[model samples]
Target: MFAQVRHQLCPDLAIDLGTHQTRVAVGGRGLILDEPSVVAVDSESRRILGGGAAVGRVAKQMIGRTPDGITAAYPIRGSVVHDFDLCEAMLGSFLRKTGRSKLGLKPRVLMTVPGAISPVERRAVTNAAERAGAGDVFLIEQSRAAAVGAGLPISEPIANWICQIGAGTTDIAVLSLGDIVVRRARRVAGEAFDEAIAAYLRREYSLKVGSRTAERIKHEIGSADPLDEELVVEVSGIDTAGAVPRKAVITSEDVREAIAPVLQIMTEELRATVESCDPELAADLADVGLVLSGGGAQLRRLPEYFERQLGVPVRLVDDPARVVIRGTALCVDHFRQWRPYFESAA
Candidate 1:
């Protein structure tokens, strides 16, 4: 009863702490905050810039462009907390932005984690959230969250496949009866695609580009399959050999070729995951197909690419990038029903 009243006064929060982005949603309210998972700090002091306010979108804008003595850092990497202090600070800042702190109650927080998170990593997440003013911290698997958010019939005795390709990791899982049966996670995701693009430019064009520029190129023209009418975009970078600025026209074909190897690896992992499942569950996948969610799901022709590669239909959920957070929010709203599925990091 006390917990219910406390929750009524200050609703719980659901957080999707991704490598490239962090999203927060209230128990009853929908998503309230979505920002890049970045923090700007003083290089020497290692203190956050702007009185600890240079976080999220502000700090993200400084990536690859910050002047000397100002460094932009990502506290989370590959869906895990890499720097505890920075992550706590970042999460605290985001929580304050939601105005829950003003209620003088520490809200219980439900956070999504990668399926293969280690014990130490799980503890780190719980500790960070507690230090960030959370009353209680719960963890949910990202793939399961994606399944729930995509509106999959996970409670039914059928297979529900989900592929959540985020900035730092890809979570693949087959869920049934509200539980995950087979799962796989990989570090190669959107960041890997950007790195592939950068490396390709450096090798073929002798051009040096930052991660932001590479990401821009990918969004502008990158593809997983051949297009009926190819596209091209102008790229500006430093000449690797000459140490001079240069510009080049890069085609969609080049981007596709650059990222194909990374995509191929993900495909193989997905195939292995499917093969590891029971024959009945595996066969069910052929009918229910795969659901794609996350920021990387927005990659052009990704669904088509997966469909052709896996011999299964691929469906991309609406607002794929927000799927995990949405699912976490749903869990928060129906905590009693979903509580059994949550793993208490504490």
Candidate 2:
């Protein structure tokens, strides 16, 4: 008990390493670092550039705007780290910025992951956290972390189904007895949504837009169903016909059309996972319904879309984008009690 208390008192950290973004939280301090998973590097100097003074929002602006010598790369993709070196550099910067409340005391770490992440990837993620300054590293599958964050009674034996649509991937899980009963992971998420929107413009409007622009359009007018008002947002892109920059207006209907296929795919994936669940667990889900959380949950009519497709009510938790981080902090706050359930880096 004394050792457990000592370990629990350490200034711990919780990191949600998504392909599109990385969120770092100090157990007691809330979120201190939230930024795109991108890192800008100067190839010749072999040094990470623009991360010290410009993390989160600032570094994000450097995307598609870097000079000849510099390159912006995402260390993570589809909720897994793809570039170990860049990932380490990125994690180091975040840890430095997300300072510990206690000086010189190393923090025990809890890094989040997708439930289906392979053993090889798990070891790599754990190693990276240790190298990046965590005293001890533990992995929490994203769906479980998310379920906790969404306020599901996962500790109870009844079923709780959740779908987390993040920037890089969509994770669906059915929980009971504090363990996942059914799990499904899909890489079709926000980034894919942006690509779909961009492709739609290219074909219909004869315009070329960057991923960022498409994302803006999605947020401003994106929807999976009809809106109270048919809104329009002005978009700037290179006109395919003129090969010059031009401004065009996109409507909610256009946005819906662009996103339909992928939305259908997401819905189908969740439904399929639910269908394949064990008979006893499947019966539980019918009464409990499913909860949708994450950045993609912010999309208009997304819940309704899921509800319609599955015939099971879909509810969105508050501030879905922060659910993973919040749940991570919750885990840290209760680490001593949960430690045995989590495997450490060692």
Candidate 3:
């Protein structure tokens, strides 16, 4: 049949165009691509370096270490397309890497976006994907994708609370009956935590480090709550006072202190979201509890921190980082059933 031949030529793709990372999944296949959302370009020409091959993991490594003529940049910021041309280029490269381009047919793509992006931002995502070799484009909110990815009973009458904390944004939502009831999206998340750590080092230790190094320190020792055995990591950075390389031993306690303000803001936001819910839904939430996903969900003791702050049961989903893409992929596999929830970007 023509449909079968078309399917063989080009299948559907589910893409999570995250601020920190980009993930892709095929309709009949699981995740096939996971890479940092980074691209290296010529400083003057603004052309993608290495004939467009300097992207993803390769470009991520060039950050904070690029030569004078080369720059590493993230085309997506806060889960929105910040640089249209670069985003198109980066996505095109990723699509080609998937080998779908070789079939000479554009694939239909389902992409996840933050719940709070403006109409213009929404269009930009579709435009970028279209220009990047997609035949048709569909958009879905990240929070909904996270809910589905976490295997929550979103179609039930009871409330399902999902908080997806990624690198640049946090999407908090309450869902029931396959739709969002109330949601909050904020630009504060993993990147803020990294910035806080970097600033703390600069202010408290007179050590200046790059974002990547700070992120490393965070992953190694960061915690929201006290650990049974606190961790310590040696960090290398430039001494602001002497302008020379130096090393400092930072503890989990220090990281917690540095990121406390950011965490406080997130906690307040979550509380506000809960308060915004109707009394009936709020009651349902109290019983069902919160489901946490995304990379930030892996923060040390984060579930315990939220439990103490929100006074509710908190559950972190398995493979938290891939939840959105996985859920989006699930939708792709069952497009007919999930079609009503998607906004057509074609």
Candidate 4:
């Protein structure tokens, strides 16, 4: 029945399995699903929610906001799936939604994988999608996806440097001829930024906060360095003792100091990556500088910090949040032409 047709033909899907989120674009019909990597399960029933309520923005809101009897979790971690069973279920939701719109087209997905995972890790991604109802799967590195999203000429000979700072990992790469010449993947990105903020608040303000609260603070007032005139924002959280409610006006400088070590490590990784690049590609980078893409790029002063450390120009992309997804869609749409640029399929 449905299985026969699914095995024979399916539309193509592009997935950005980021630490913070998983974005699915079906033949690039403009990102069919954009959801937190979280999945909610009814343990007693051992069943998943209806596809209608299991995917996309709705699922994101349920995070940290869900009620009892429904437990939530992220099947993916550090850009790789840690729980394939749950990952497949989550993917199935997106596939169902996409098929409803396309009138029954099973999709062959091209997913973005971190450059750091091993071949075994890569196979886990393909296996999860197949179990989730994918007819076929292709794996593209996160940096390559980001490069394409940033409009870097990866197919050409020029070296295009891309650094994707995401929720769970930062992928730094020097790309030429559509291949990664030098790259580094680290689990220091948006989540780390939030952690840095949390640590800073605890150390400086004696305030205890959850990761979500810190993420809000990072987005609202976090910076790599102090602004010309520091800005302040009122924050609400509990005191360290017995979770008493408290409020404070935390300044941008506080955030800057909290996230300093993270920024330094990120910039240092970029510098080291550049140092490892082939001379020709390194020379090419001089002209191209560095293009920052990913959720982490939105942090203030990041560009200046990298520019100073790498001694090269650094600029953030136009849309940082969806860069990886956009690039994934672009490749999935042109799978025939760009398929060669992806990693070796296991």
lDDT, candidates in the order shown: 0.92, 0.83, 0.93, 0.81
| lDDT (Cα, 0-100) at 113 in candidate 2 | 85
Name the 10 consecutive residues with the lowest summed lDDT in model 3.
59-68
Tell me how far the alpha carbon of residue 232 in candidate 3 is from the true structure, in angstroms, after superposition: 1.3
Give each model a TM-score.
0.97, 0.91, 0.96, 0.90
Evaluation by lDDT, superior candidate among 3 and 4: 3
Q: Could you tell me the lDDT of residue 79 within candidate 1?
A: 93
Model 1: ten consecutive residues of lowest lDDT: 59-68
- Could you tell me the C-alpha RMSD of candidate 1 in Å? 1.4
Best by TM-score: 1
lDDT of 3 by residue, 166-265 (tens): 9989999999998899999999999999999999999999999999899999999999999999999999999999999999999999999999999999
Off by over 4 Å in 3: 61-68, 101-103
Candidate 1 positional error at 18, Å: 0.9
lDDT value, residue 283 of candidate 4: 85
Clashes, model 1: 0
Ranking the candidates on lDDT from highest down gives: 3, 1, 2, 4
lDDT of 4 by residue, 103-133 (tens): 4554667888887888888888888887777
Total residue pair clashes for candidate 3: 0
lDDT of 3 at 342: 96
- The alpha-carbon root-mean-square deviation between model 2 and the true structure, to one decimal in Å, is 2.5
